[model samples]
Target chain A: MSRGDWASWLESWRQQLVLWLESTPAGDFVNTYTWAWPIAESFHFVGLCLLLGTVGLFDLRLLGFARQIPLPQLHRLIPWGIAGFSINAATGSLFMAAAPFQYLYNESFYFKATFLSVAGVNVAVFYLLFYRKIVPLGAGEQAPWPARIIGGVSLLMWIGVMCAGRLLTFYRPSFRFF
Target chain B: MDPVFIWLEQTALSVWVRESPSMFAFPGILTLHTIGMAFLVGLTSAFSLRILGFARRVPAPEMLKLVPVVWFGFFLNLVSGFLLLLAYPTKALTNPVFYLKLTTIALALLAVRALGRRVADLSFRPVRGWPGDRVLASLTLGFWVVSVTAGRFLAYTHSRLLASDF
Candidate 1:
């Protein structure tokens, strides 16, 4: 699609999101959720740490650091990482529901979402391609080249997600700005 | 303590952080703090899990080397976090959630340091068949995760925004 088409499409989505957000009564307990936003945001950050912590270690290992650690054992951390991602997704949805237009129209938010999607796909691909081969291997076994490539890609994708997420506030494109 | 808070509120750095027109001032600092949290908490939890025997092939002591990387992240957050606190001393100090966050962080750091010291004493080889060691590692990892969660909640739960009556 052309840039204009893409922009229009995005704008329509933004409008729909804003309508949904506004439909909820502002004074409703669910709307305010008595400290829900902060709590969810906190959980989001916590999840980020958990996800990154577990995945980053395995990626580092694939890059050949701490060679003595078995891939399977290190892979044990993946469940916690997945749990963290789940927390983030839940909290993130709440934020979006709370202030849909603000995020939907924001360029930084767009980039963050794009990066997050890419990271998710990268992770899925990693497991699909390498998990079977690597899981049953003995300790100290070198990761296959495909696994190494997947690890490297996963690392880059996540770092991109982090940087883009951090840059969101800086790059928000408001309607006024447009 | 109130006087100290009042004085901090009047400090030049605090004034600039809170009042500067540039988004780069407060917003940028907040962004940096978040990023630092990602790396610091991320790497520390990773290393802590390694110590707990999550990745046995990775020598426990070797994982200690990643400690420096984790510390680098922690230092970044420390600086950024202090800047944030300085900007609004009362906002943080008066908030129950902030205290919880601080306490959680302290526990996480203590667990990490204690675990690191133990890891450092070990040889590169795995210390096989010690269940307690794994438990310690798991707890250390869990503590850091909880700390991160608590810290995030601080933003939601703070009761006050500034030190002044105005």
Candidate 2:
């Protein structure tokens, strides 16, 4: 599709999806409870730490930064990173459902989603192409070139995601509540 | 309004940070601060977990290789945090939670340094006498949790957003 056509198509879909989200009970819950939103935000930050600490650290190791920490052993910390991602996904959904249009039409939100997708693809690429080759590598050994590229991409994508996420409030496109 | 804060709010740098329409001012600084928090807290917690014996096979001393990265995050935060404080002097200065956040970070770093020394003291043998190290690890973890919590609370708990608002 042409760029204009794609943009229009996304705009209509965003309108319809946001309308549906406005009717969700989850949205009402977040709006009704004063403390709920802030608490969830706190958890979101906490999860960010966990994800960056574990997964980001693993990425740095793959880039040959911490050579003595064995890759396979360090991989053990990834489950916790997954847990962090789960927390962020759950809390992130609440924010979206609470005011879908706020994000659906927001330019920064678009950037955030794009970066998130890139990060996901980076992970998929790593596991599919480089995981087997890099898994058995011992401490002090440099990861292969492909693995380093994935690691670098993972870090950049995540940082992009974070920047866009933080800019969401500033880029809300519409002033209407629903 | 307090004179210091009033003077601070009127200063060119602070005013630019708070009032400038440019995204690179407030939003960019805040984003950097959050990124730094993740690196500093995340790496520190990872090291703490290792010290607490979570990843037993990973060589403890080798983990210290991450110390410089952690410090990079720390310095990033220090600068970004100062910019934020300058942006809203009254808001952060008056809030008790802000002080608590600083204290928590200080304590956590102290714990991390002590633990680092303990790790460096190890001689590439099987780990031993780790009870104290574990205790320090737990303390560091607790401090970071509190620090992050306090930092998050500063937004809600602040009685004023600007000196004039109060």
Instruction: Give the number of the best model, judged by DockQ.
Output: 2
TM-scores of the candidates are 0.79, 0.94
Residue-level lDDT tens digits of model 2 in B62-97: 888898999999999999999999989899999999
lDDT of 2: 0.88
Candidate lDDT scores, in order, read 0.74, 0.88
How would you class the docking of model 1?
Answer: medium
Q: Per-residue lDDT for B120 in model 2?
A: 85
Instruction: Give the residue spans of candidate 2 off by over 4 A.
Output: A1-8, A176-178, B124-129
Which residue runs of candidate 1 sit more than 4 Å off their true CA positions?
A1-6, A20-32, A124-153, A166-178, B21-23, B47-58, B122-135, B138-142, B164-166
In angstroms, give how far residue B103 of model 2 lies from its true place. Answer: 1.2
The true-versus-predicted C-alpha distance at residue B145 of model 2, in Å, is 1.7
